[model samples]
Target: MRVRRLKWAEEFLGSAEVVVQSPQDIKGNWNTYMNRECIHLEIGSGKGDYWIKMSDMYPDIGWIGMERNESVAAYAVKKSEEAKENRKFIQNEAMHLLDYFDKEIDAIHLNFSDPWPKKRTTKRRLSHGNFTSIYKQILKDDGELHMKTDNSALFEYSVVNILKEGFSIEELCVDFRRETHDEDAISEYEQKFMNKGNPIYRAVFKKVKEEN
Candidate 1:
C-alpha cells in the first residue's frame, strides 16, 4: 500500500533538528553530529521505533535512520525529538547510501525491508548481491549486517546472497520472537506481526576479511 503523502511533511521535517534533508552534506562526519565514535545505520527505518529505542538502550553508540518516504521519515524524526535523542534521520533512498556514508560505519541493520517478491525485481531486494556489494563497500572490515523479516522467501534469499557475497552467517533464527535475546528490542512492525502469531526470521552476517 502506498503511503498517503502528508501535506505538512516537508515543512514539519524541515523544522526537525534530527532530520538531515541532504545526507551527503554530512558524508563522513556522521559521528561528529552524535558526538560518538561508533555509528550504526538502519536502512528503511520505519517510524524510527527500533533505532530510537536502541539509541536509548545503547547510549554510547550513534544511530542513523535512513528512510526514503518523507511522510514516514517525518514520523521517525518526530519520535526522535519526543525522546529527546540526537539520533539522525536521512531522508533519502537507500540505493544512494554511498553518497551519504563513508567506510566508517560499524554496523548496518535491515529491519523488515521490502521483499521485492517479483522474479524480475529480485535484484532490487536489500539483500541482493548488488546491494550487498554496496553494503560491503561502506561497512568496516569487521562490520556486521543484521537483518530481520517476516517474509520467509526474502530471508532465504538474503542468506543465499549474503553467503555468495563472502559474508559469514554468525547467527540465524527462523522464529525470532521465540528465540530473541534479552538485548533485542522489537520494532513496531515486528511487534505487530508477532502479536498476530507470525514468525520472524533474523540473521547476522559478518564480512569475512580476505586473507592477504
Candidate 2:
C-alpha cells in the first residue's frame, strides 16, 4: 500500500500525502511499497534530521520514519518535503510497530532516544527488554538494531537489557563520534553534542534465526 505524493508535504502527517494513513495495512509490504530491497525504520525520529538525511544519503534503501509526537513529526516532514521517494512517515508510537510491520524490516535505527533515567520508568526506554521483544518480532532473522545516544547511563542500560533479551552484540563503540563513519550521518544535534565533549555511544545488535 504505497502512499501517493499528493500535495507538498504538510506538517500534519496524518493528513499529509507522504504518510501512510493506515500503516497496519502495509505490514510485510513496506519494501514492496517503497520498491526497495531493504527497509530501515527509525523509531522516535524526533525533528527528523537523521531520518531525512539518511533517506537522502541512501536513496536505494527504503526509509520509514516513525515519530509519535505529531508536532515533531511535522517538523521533519516539512523539512524533507521534496524527499518523498523511497520514504514514508508514520505518526504513531513504536509499540504499535507490530501492527504496521511484520518480520520484514531489514534494520532498525534508534538515534538519541530518550534516556528514561528514572528507575521506575526503565521500561519506557526504547531499548528496554519489552521494546527489544517487539524489535525481534518485526526484524528479519539477520536484521540489525543500530542505536546511538549521548546518555551514558541509557547506553549502558540498553546494552545490558538488549543482551538480556538474547540479541547478539555485533558492534559496540563507547565513543561513536571518535571515528569518521562516512556511511553513517551525524545530525546537527549530535554534532553539537560532540562539540561539547560529549561522547556518543553506539551499538549494533544482530539477530540470527536458529536453524531447525
Candidate 3:
C-alpha cells in the first residue's frame, strides 16, 4: 500500500542515516544529534506518533522506534526532528532489533504488535520466544519491556512465552483503561480499539540475569 506522505515528514529526510543494515548501522558512540545514555526502543512503531510525544514529554531519555515500512518510518523521523534533542527512527524489521541496538536500552515497548493468530503462523507473533530472545540480547540487565495488546489470545500466549524465556512479570493488567493506569501515552491503534469497545491488556516484564 502506498502510504500518504505527511507534510511534516519531508524535513528530516537525508539528515539521518537510513539504516537498512541491521545492528551494523547503530553506533554506540554518541553523536551531536543522538543520546548516549538511558535509551529506549519501540518495536513496530507504525507512524511513530506516540514515541514522538514521549520524546517531548521525557527530555532526558533517548527514544528510538523501529519500523520496516519506509513511509511510516518517515513520519516518525520527521516528527522526531521537532524534539531532535534525543530521538531517532530506524527503518528496520522488528526481528532485527538486536542488530541495531546493543545492550544499552533501558526499556522496550511493544504496542499492539501483529497477533499472527493462525495456528500455523505462531512464529510470526512478536511475543514469541524467538523475538524475546532477541530482545534479551539488546536489553541491559534489569531492562523492562512494556507490552500492550487488544487480542486476548495473544496476550495470554505472551505471558506464557515470556515466562518460558526467563523473564519475570512485574506488572500485568487485563483491563488497562479502567485500571488505575497513570495517564500514559496511547498509540493510534490503541485509541481505535478503545472506540470499538475492546479492552486493552498491559504488562511489564523484567529481564532475568543469566547465571553461568
Candidate 4:
C-alpha cells in the first residue's frame, strides 16, 4: 500500500487533535478519555472510512483507530477533522498494541486487513498467532473480535489461528453482504468489492476466559 506522499499529510499528523500523541500513557484510562463505558479498537484502519463511520454509528462507545502509516493516518484524521470526542487515532502498528491498551477493550475490529498472502509474510497478517497472542492479553474476558474480509484464504487462516489461540466463534458469515447489515458500515474497499460481485466474509470470535 504505497501511497504517493501528500504534502499536507505530514503537517496534519503533527498537529491533529484527534491523533493521540502518546497512546501508551493513557493505556488503562481509555474509557475516561472517551467518556464512554465501552471501548472498541480497529487495527490496520486504512484511510479511516470504517473508523470514522463506525464511531458515528455507535456514539455510545469509544472508538479508536490504529494505523502505522503516518500519511494514511493523517488523511483519516484530516477527513474527520471534526471527529467527535469519542474517537481517537493511534499512529502505530499492531505489534505495539499492548503498550496502548489493557484488558478492558470490549471489542476489536479488523476490516479488510492486509492478507499478507505469502508464506514468508505470514507473520505480518493481523490474524496471525503472534498478534492474536497479544490480542488475548489485552482483550477482556468475553471481549469479542470482529473481522471482515473479501479474501477467502485470509478468512480461513484467521479462523484457524483465532480458534487455536483461545477464542470461540460466535458467528460466521460467508456472504455477509448478501443480506442487509445496517449495523455495520461498508468500507471503501468493501463497496468496491461488492460492486464487483465479491462475497464478503465476516466472523465474530469471543475470548474464552481461562477457567479458574
Best candidate according to TM-score: 4
lDDT digits (tens) for residues 1-212 of candidate 4: 56777788777787888989888999888889999999999999989999999999999999999999888887788888795888999998899988888998999999999999999999999999999999988898889999999999999999999999999999999999899999999988899999999999999999999989
Per-residue error (Å), model 4, residue 208: 0.3
Clashing pairs in 3: 23-99, 23-100
**lDDT, model 3:** 0.77
Across 1-212, the per-residue lDDT of candidate 1 in tens digits comes to: 25788889899988787777777878888778678889899988978899898888888888888888999888788777663345778888788988988887889999999889999999878898878888888888899999999999999889998999989999998997886576878988888889999999999999888788
Q: Please identify which of the two predictions, 2 or 4, would achieve the higher TM-score against the true structure.
A: 4
Off by over 4 Å in 4: none
TM-score to true structure, per model: 0.92, 0.92, 0.85, 0.97
Q: What TM-score would you give candidate 3 relative to the actual structure?
A: 0.85
Q: Is candidate 1 or candidate 4 better by lDDT?
A: 4
Q: Work out candidate 2's RMSD over C-alphas.
A: 5.0
RMSD of each: 1.8, 5.0, 3.4, 1.0
Question: lDDT per residue, candidate 3, 100-142, as tens digits?
Answer: 6677778988888888889999998888888899989888899
lDDT rank order: 4, 2, 1, 3
Instruction: Give per-residue lDDT, candidate 4, residue 173.
Output: 99
> Model 1 — which ten-residue stretch has the worst lDDT?
79-88
Off by over 4 Å in 2: 1-11, 210-212
Which of candidates 3 and 4 reaches a greater TM-score?
A: 4
- Of 2 and 3, the candidate ahead on lDDT is 2
Collision pairs in model 4 = none
